[model samples]
Target chain A: MISARRAILVSARTLQRTKPLRFADPKKIRLREPIVPTHKNFDVSPDHPLWAFFRDGNKTETVLRSKDDLSTDSRPWDMPELRLKSFDDLHRLWYLNALERNRISTEAEVAKEIYNGDVSLFTKLDDNHLMTQKRIKQTLLERQVAYERAQLSSPEEYLQLFEDKYINADESAIAEYNEKLVRLQYAIFGIEPDLSEYNLEEDINVKFVEGLSYVAKLKLGRYLASNPGALELPLNGVMEELPFLVRDPEVAVEEVRAMREEGVSRKLDNIEVFAFLRNAIEAVRSEPEELAEEEN
Target chain B: MKSTSFKCTCIISQHSPGHVLACTSCSRICSLIQFHLFQIDSHLKFPNTNEINQNLKHTIPFYLTAEQSFSWLIQSTLSKCHVTSLLLFFSKLQTSLRPISITSTMSFKTAAKRGQFDLDRYVGNLRVKTYKEFAKHSRLPTIPAPIPTLRKDERLIGEAPIVAGDLAYIVSGKHKGKISRVLLYTRDNDTVLLNEVTKNVVIPKQYWAANQTSHVLEYPVPIPRKFVRLAAKEKDEKGNVSYVVAEDLVFKEKYYDDRLKRWVPRRFVKHHENIEIPWPSPMSEPKDDQYSTLTEDVYNKTHELQTVAKSPFPKSVLNELRNPYSKFKKRELTEGQARRLNAPQMPLSVEQKIYLAKKAQTPVKKLEPLSEEAKDLIGSRMAEHLAKIKNPLLLKHLEAVSQKTTPEFQRVLNEIEGKQD
Candidate 1:
């Protein structure tokens, strides 16, 4: 009676003994089954034989008609439903097919006979093959024209254009543009934009939004007002209780002023700020009656 | 008196026969008669007999006969005649026989009397008077003049005057060779302090870079030369002895065991020993010549190797044998043994376990499920594949044939999906 471990070892030894001594030729092998079904409903019997024949015949006729017509039609044959997807996906598929064909033939044959020498024809066929592709290119061109017109019309846009063109046009341009956008957003809102405002991932954005909302609640402000000597404590305590609120000087100053008006002016000392914030937050969180009693 | 001065004639015979006398008198008989008359006259003249006899009463009498008396009377008349002459004779004889006394008792007695006299009081009074006279003359008592006080700058004058040695302290340099004995004040320039005890030590003011005086080197005794040699020997002997002694007592006196008493040795001791060989013969070699005799020799050389050879089992066999007690050392497993060990056990998810069990039971060939559609599609493609495979021109077409049928291709796809999962 052999154990499982002994059996496995015996099998391994048998496999080693029976294995082939020479490597097999990969090119000589052939598959009896289909490689990958293109569609979930793929069948052996041709459902559109007449359409396939017309397409094949048209491709040949187009080749004889004009080199440009053949090249235009040489793009990957898209399924009718594929036109509804993004232009980028259609273009990716087209390039993938072209690469596959090129692997079978030389690049020269594909470029000369398939893509045709005319760049316009290639572009037109790709645009016609996918309606989304034509729409995207038109929108891009229109956006460029409109941007140019806007740059010419306003001094600010003109300045931005000048900076992009002469000052930081090459590698730093996008970074500079993003910095300016953030600055403009900060100026308009008087606060940094929350991560969710940019439609970031739910977990990350939610955490960021929650953190920002915690900052905006002025929980630290209320704590500072309630605790008279908390601001005099070390930064560690103040930072731990209300990490987000302590970072902003305006919020801190406003909170200090609120505490002062409430006759708890002594809490404004920087060292005691955390203790004050904690007390203020506690006061704000307590029941209304308790808070009123504390106020008194 | 000149009426008749009788010349005394006398036959005067002196005792000493060496004298002869010629008297200036009358003729011989007359001279004789004169001598007799002088004697009688001299006798009468010597003083009245009765009166002389009366005066000599305290003296002893001298008796003479009538003849001798008549002769005396005649001699007396002659003596009277030449008294000066007789007198001269008597004087000469007296001068010649006179006795001289050398010692004078009167002078010694006079000196004694003088010594016995009371002169001390007079002498003492004279001394007082002399002293008074001196005092009166000088107007002061005679005392040794107070050692004339020396001025601050004045040096006492005398032959080989005793000048104090320099008073000095080591100020700035090493040793500064501080000395108090100012040996020589040469040329009134510099003073040298002789460290006589130290010998060859002559320190000058320049040495100390200061001028000081009033110190003296007292109790200066030279160091004995023998002391230096004794010190050096002591140090050398002590050093060697110290090295041989215990570390803590290296600098202290040490004692060694003697016959009857503990005594420190003056020199180092050396010891030697003779080694004895127990086994003298070389070892015997093995019969097999392929092996070196040295290995066999070593095996026979040691008692350990001999003991090892006496054991029943070979060394390798002994090592390979498992200990019988090890079976009792097996650990018993507790419930939830995997949690205690922190080892991952077989996954317990029902679906995962079932799938794994199924995989374990299925045959490799039947692992992939066959769909009806896939089957139908494959059936149709089989004809095409067969046609393509037979045609030589279809070699190119065969190249397009996908590798779906190969187990390796399916395995690669499955691996990719597995990684993604």
Candidate 2:
């Protein structure tokens, strides 16, 4: 009456007579729970063939490592923070991210090979890392859109991206453009004169940090606010203290410009703010030629 | 007469006997041999035309006068051995053209680097850029990006072929006639990665390079889609899998589910129309172990669909939701704050509104007229335009018609039609 599948299954085992259950029942412990076998622990040493898979950032840690061990200092950058970061920083981050991704994937692949359907932690780790990768791109994309807008609003920034078109522009039109430019400068950067003429003591050596749009300058200001370390310079006070809302940016922009125009540039006693500002300005203004230098 | 023979380091174009242009981007950095055009009046040669006389020499510094693009022929001879020469024929792009007096402007070459000028630098630059891009692309991580097999390639998922998991037979290359799984498809290159036909590549260990450096990483090399064929994996009653050549498999755009919420691209055999070839699904979907996020919540579907599409752009995209782990980020807003700021309302307060309404009720009725001198100038320009009407009948009609417009409108007309090209 048995099916062929059952017959085949039965044929593989040795025939036996019915015996009394010594351990009460086969799988059941009537009165007490059964003892569980202890799991042996092992580490993937640097000597292992697939050790590269275990890398997190600087150190090679196992994917099974507890979440608490993850670097607390480092964080996935927000769009605003990313705006303040340099292209080189982003590019390097992207490259670093690819390595991180590869490491995670390699670990997942190896783990799957050893025990499939149990590398859920690696997958979770990957999901966590995936956001950071996406954020990098989001930051870049925001910059690209801003760059395009900046290109349209002002022909001055990366229109040197290809070739300089405004060099031979009509004198009268340029005069008119500069008049318009000064008004926009007042609105956006809070500089009274054109950014080129705004007599900040420090040389704005990199391309055009003074002319960064409201978004860029605001992030720089926010970055200064979230003081990793304070500013290097002796500031009059923090010129960018008030929190600027991205939705209504004009209010904050006007306030900064208004304060400066009234001869009251807020002084700040912060460390790396100016230093970070200088570095950020340099990063934002990086050209392809400058990128070549940065990559080296 | 030119005293010096400018035996340049650059290789002149074979098609056109002109200066060998440097890779315009790297030209500044790379210390290549130079050719000063003004230093030695290099004879501009076209493909078939003979060397021209003095008039053509005068035309050397010629400005492109017409609005239409004139193709400037230059040849890009790279230093690479056995490399086919890229003939650079760049049409004057409108974006590059500076709007100014042609007479007043200097020759474009004079303004550029003292090195050789090539208007066609853009064309050659693209190929070089593609090469550089490929170089970066080749150095990707050891692990392949997890692309779902039968999943329709959306903007979020990126571009993927309909027959993603099906067996692909190589039609060309060293792995010709070899059957392999179509591991990946890149829309940018229109190439497909074959799982079996792999190549050993050394991925750098860091951002500089990373992965399997000890034992060079084995990457599934992607070939152009043209050299691959979809061979559907079919099994007989015995359950032995055999790949059947599916040359006439037609891709049909159809709804995957009864709800019609999702559209999956599917293929069916042309010969046996009923035999639908479903793309082989990946072993498991890369889902989070945590909460399940609906597609509507994940994506901003408002752009693609006309309907509200389930509350487009979730709070995360709007910068109102903060990352759980981030302590440095200060982007999130409270529920009330988000609602208040995002609301569509006028900026003016009640006091300002009342003041504005009061001002509107009692408007300044006084109006000023243009001074006599200003009136004369405006009238004169309008008359001058009126004089240009050659036909006596039309001139009379225009003169009478001009009286209908204000002096400001006449000034605007003069401004529009006044500029001489």
Candidate 3:
């Protein structure tokens, strides 16, 4: 009644039991095999060696060291002369602060959940730890600011620094953009635009195209046919049809320039491979003398 | 034994040699055979007699005798020696062995101190010898040599009058805020020994430095005679709070003493003989006695007599300006008093509304011809307006009415009748 695979397995097991493979120096020889690498890639990615220290899943259940010994202190250590610390020192402090912040937030969440969200319990349970962590974070931030200020050589540099640190899209503008994106998604999928209690996966249904315009509906239908099981519309084609949803030309141009500078190759649409090769060859041949000099 | 089986290490040609291990087919000789033999010889012992005898049986030719075969075997075994010479010749053939072609390896000479001095040859006993040990000393002076003190007359070398008690302000240098009294004067280097005059304590001889330019100068301000307030306050309507100076409520009058090239009180002259300047006002006033003395009475009488010739200042200003001590004392107003004087005002009474009404009625009075010049201006303006009337509708109506009433209408009718006839 046994299959060939089962028979082979049984015979192999019997053979192994009858005569085990013996090493010349069994005591000296390592019993364990060489460690199998967790990562297959050498370059930067989720599977890279750089991410080896991180957990496999989003839920971080790994608690290092003694959690019971944690205690609260009213006064936190103050580093008023943090600005005097070297770049390496500041970098270390910043990393430590970040680690502490992550630990505190996780701990606080766990504690809150355990106590049924009774926040007053936090006072008894290492509350000062969070406060001290924040203080340390602030100290590190101040040190960074001071260091940056010291490094700045001119008003232009200061302006650039300020832009790098503080400048971002306005909150209201981001909210409006998000709303517009949601609306576009609704229109494309032919779902009723209800932001009050919306869940993208559950709410989006291709069958409900009654609210969508003819062109949008057609685009959605084609996209669905081409890319089955996709929840969102194909952005490029959809954006062309919806002019208002398209990003600013200047911003798009800036993004393109940034990408080009970062060495991202542009997709050569409608051009033959041979023509592309020829153009690349011509460009390489006609490269500027400074680049040639740099090579030398 | 496997002489015929020898293969060339070259991958392209698998040539077997006829006698010597040279590839006739490929027209090439592999020098690797010599290296192979050498490697085998170095790793294992050199092939002994038995191995040689065995090789001879297989490899020797049939025409050769035993001696000849033995010699041939020996030659074959030592064929490497001849091959090496051949290799050397071939290598020489490929590359010219000329002096110019032969290159020597480049080497560098490092710069370093390589010699050591022979101390024994130079001198013996390098250690220094001293009989007196500093640590073994029994007595040590607690203080260094006594400081030399300069004579008073020896210090008075300047033409300008210098006194010991003269106070000087540090006009410049790091010790700027310091005010000191001259303890001793030295005119040789224009230096002075000074004692710092701090509150209730005189730190004697704190410095004895030369009086460089702008270092120390006479405190060039006289003691003020009377205090005066700088800012004036206007009286409020209630009259309960009178006007007072807001800033520097009590200020003293300071004067410069040109002769001493310093500032001092009027009492400074009292120290000098043959000077008859009397101390004035509060300087001579008895501290506890509020009653005016005979000298005060005389001073007041003279002041009053002098005022009779000229208009006197108001009593309020005179009283307030007289005493600086009292003025300073009065600056500390109670919280209630301060609030009453400076708190936000209540809305003005109806009796105070006359000004607002007058302000509102400004246009009425403003438009009125209050003066003869104004009336004349209005009259001229009216005449100018009347003169500017051209092509009026009323004039056109009047002209039409006159035309209807005129004889021209009848003439025109008669002319029409004549034409018909």
TM-score of each: 0.13, 0.24, 0.15
What local lDDT does model 1 show for residue A109?
17
lDDT of 2 by residue, B1-421 (tens): 2111111222121222221211122221112322211111122122211222222233322112221111111111111110111111111122333332121233222322234332234344564454455455443555443222221232224324434566888878788889888776666456687779887766554533333345466777667777887777778999999777655666577655433223566677778777777767653344433323344433422122111112222334334333455655547876777798896776999999999999999967653456799999999998898777789989778769857988777666565666433
Off by over 4 Å in 3: A1-67, A81-84, A113-296, B1-369, B372-421
Give the per-residue lDDT digits (tens) of candidate 1, residues B348-395: 898988998999998775344557999899989977777657667677
What is the descending lDDT order? 2, 3, 1
Q: What does the lDDT read for residue B77 in candidate 1?
A: 33
Interface RMSD for all numbered candidates? 96.3, 37.3, 42.9
If both were scored by lDDT, which would come out higher, candidate 1 or candidate 2? 2
Residue pairs that clash (backbone atoms under 3 angstroms), model 3: B221-B263, B224-B253
| Whole-model alpha-carbon lDDT for candidate 3 | 0.34
Over B172-260, each residue of candidate 3 has an lDDT whose tens digit, in order, gives: 44445455554544443234444652212222233323443442333222111111111212356787653322221221234555444
Candidate 1: tens digits of C-alpha lDDT, residues A1-296: 44423433344443343333342353554323322211112222234222222223212221112342334323323233342333344345445444433222212212333333323433344344354343433433343344345434434454345334433334446456446534443332222443223312222222333333333333343344445455543323332334333335345645654654676444235555534544544444455778689999
iRMS of candidate 2, one decimal?
37.3
Estimate the overall C-alpha local distance difference test score of candidate 1: 0.33
- Weakest ten-residue segment in model 3 chain B by summed lDDT: B101-110
lDDT by residue for model 2 (A3-22), tens:
42233234323222255213
10 residues in a row with least lDDT, candidate 1 chain B: B224-233
lDDT of 3 at A22: 34
Q: How displaced is residue B187 in candidate 3, in Å? A: 71
